[model samples]
Target: MTDQKKAKKKALKDSQLIVRIAGSERDRFVSLCDTLDTSAAREIRRFIRGFLKEHDDQLDGQ
Candidate 1:
């Protein structure tokens, strides 16, 4: 197998989230993830970072 195949296979293995997307949305998200070659953990971290940046101040007071 080549590098791209290896990377995708590793991604399938390493991802931990059981995201329950279905049909076209599932295909679209998987394709987008594949294009980015990004791990699920990394994606979640990025999401959290963005969320924090947008809402950390509100969170602190609560």
Candidate 2:
């Protein structure tokens, strides 16, 4: 594969995070994602990236 193709195929995620929520809340969130034709992981990643970008300055001091 070309270098550009290899770069495109590389994994963007290299870490894991775990969160706990009430069982019913978890079920509802998963169901909502399914209804929207998306996965819970994908939604969480999207939210995290947006959140980080929004508050990047706060993180820069860490």
Best by lDDT: 2
Local distance difference test scores for all models: 0.77, 0.91
lDDT of 2 by residue, 1-62 (tens): 99887776575765689898999999999999999999999999999999999999998869
Q: Can you tell me which runs of candidate 2 are displaced by over 4 Å?
A: 1-11
lDDT of 1 by residue, 1-62 (tens): 99999999898667455666668876776678879997655776689789999998899877
Model 1 clash count equals 0
lDDT of 1: 0.77
Per-model TM against the reference: 0.50, 0.77
How does model 2 fare in lDDT? 0.91
Which regions of candidate 1 deviate over 4 angstroms? 1-22
Q: Which candidate is the best by TM-score?
A: 2
Which pairs in model 2 have colliding backbones? Answer: none
How far off is residue 62 in model 2, in Å? 2.9
